[model samples]
Target: MGLAEQRKTLGYSQEKMAELLGVDRTTVGRWESGKTSPQPCQRLALASTLKISLQDLEALLAPSQAVERGAGRPKASDHPSSGDPDEMIRREFLRILTVSGALTVLPLDEAEALADGVYRGNPADFARMNSHLWQVYQLARTKGTVYPVVRDQLATLREALSGARRGNSFPLLNAAADLFQLAGEVAFDANRYSNAAASYALAASVSKEAGAYDLWACALVRHAYVDISEQRYREAVEVLRAAERVAVRGDSALSTRHWVASVLAEALAGVGDLAGCEEALARAEEVQDLPEGSSNGGWLRFDGTRLAEERGARYVQLGRFDLAEEALKKALDQSSLAIGHSYRRRGAVLADLAVIGARHQDPDQVVTYAREALGLARASSSGYIIRRLRSLGDEFGPLSRNHRIAELGAEIAALRAS
Candidate 1:
């Protein structure tokens, strides 16, 4: 029987099932729609509710005869909810948290209770818990909620690296790389650029040792972002060049490498190296040469349409107002239709348009786009977005006498100060 039928047999509504499973109704909907299957815990709950054995639930959840031959089964284990590596890493991290006395921020008893949960949980459960904690960490603003855990996370990641270096095993090395990448992300979010760069470099080295080229390219791209943030355009160019080479060798058809190249072009443009910028842009544009759906989506995902956005931002830096305006507008339109949610990307492009408008002395457009982008950036809790806005606000310095522009500038400055 289908999941829905089983739910009906158990006399449970989607909402009810979701509540029992500690998930949303949409998750239950996905399960019933066959888009995903329940986790082992949820499966056990479902089986009990349906008066069935775990074995029976497993069989019922298996691919049906209606599935076409040679078509792969959508194994539940392959889904993000299932074999999540992040969960395991998080549990291990928490163990270090207790060991390092970082958990002292919480009541001793509460910390022990959490440690107990970590100890009892399976790897997937740990991963899911970690993922949830990270998400919570991202949205949470309290210093009490962040500092202790983040510090522990950093310590855990460092320990992983140390452990990996002591061992020559590929698994240990790969695990270290994964932890380092996570550490880098956390560090970047905290505006610890040097730490982020160091983590990315370590990740790249581990990736090389593990023979994982895609991971190496990803690390380099992350490192390049740090360089770009510092306005070290020459260093950025060098980093991107190395990243481009690694990306090409690893997976030329992937969109990420091309996206890396596109951003690299922007860095090149920052230095007034027009020729190199155009060439890098040309290479980035070549992502469309791959046949549709050829990308693995694991790495090398440069599908090319984001060029307008990149061009808009780059041209804004070059003071090419005309080009920036056209490209920025087009990017805004294209991004509106693209699938998925990237508040960061949307906010960035809108901020670029704002900068373009500011450059052209178009007060109305500047205010409209900048305010909108600022709101989105705040909603996304993006430090990078805030930094971009601050930089754009600086462009309004020449118009400081204009009350409206000055107000906008002051508002952005306030955000940066905070």
Candidate 2:
């Protein structure tokens, strides 16, 4: 029997299996569908969970030889295809992940030369590819799927840097900085705070070396998120303050400084500085006046589209439920959020609203918003949303005696395994 048959026979739903495996539900789906195989590190646990030997598990995972021969080896279509560009990018990235495994074992010089031949010595090509990867990462339901590609890209980038001439190294450094931030993002989404911090630190160092002030500032902002996630508000403020200083050196036309201020507002709110948070948020609002191309869509997407949610979140932190509810409801009215284009943003706003309900001791309101947020968390497989929901779950202490609230808490707790 196939993996899916085995799973059913064992009476394990995909979500349950995913929880036991510490992976996204989509990852488990891919394994059963024969679209991908588990990594070597994951195979032993998977085999044990399946109540099968490692050798038996491999047989189940292997593709049918007859089907393979009939269809021939899988390959990217050379002709132009129509679909979401992000989806196309994801497929291409998977292809690269497979090929890069072999390249990683080659000597550094040889790997560098091979990469150079592939890209024809143009750093812009690498930059563009990295940008696409970031878009794909943002849109992907399963964030861990991007890890192997990011890891391989970093390896190729290291080889490129080691062999580049000093005169041509700046562009490579800029590319490296950008990719490192994406790497940090993938790690951060998976709740690997230390690894994320390390990646962001490297991004900041490389950005400084490349003389890309905006990139450097953005890296520092991301680094601050690790501190913020751990509730080290003072430390986050210090990092963001440094980010603000560095952003001053970035191009005035860019929204780098304003983005720093936006994040700074969150940090200030964490420390109970209501006045400071409002001031920083006001500075962030000035980004609306900047030209259309003020921020790159990849690393710096803050174009005031998130300000409403940010304001609501900051007020929530300071315990101003009335103001928080007003702003968060306004945020939900925005077209993108109303349409549910961004599962992460919508999920976060819903979780925040649920927190407001908990604060008011309104069990029905809490359950309503929390359930919707939980649905988004499951659909998107977003760790950020899961984290917000976990915080919301903590606020359910007084309401937990309610049967519905207790069930909701159990569901949110299950995401911890995911």
TM-score per candidate, chains pooled: 0.62, 0.77
lDDT of each: 0.65, 0.80
Pick the lDDT winner: 2
RMSD of 1: 15.3
Candidate 2 error regions (>4 Å): 1-121, 335-340
Estimate, for each residue in 1-418, the C-alpha lDDT of model 1 and write its tens digit: 7778888887889998888767799987876665655543255567777688878876776653223122353332222222333332343334434433445444555544553454343323233334434443433332123333444443444444454444444554554555466667666765779988998998899889877776787788888889888889889888888877777677544565777778788789889876777787887787788768644332233567677888778777777777788888988888789864366677889888888777777888889899988787666556777878988887775666778888888888877776
Question: What are the RMSD figures for all models against the true structure?
Answer: 15.3, 8.7
- Give the number of the best model, judged by TM-score: 2
State model 2's lDDT.
Answer: 0.80
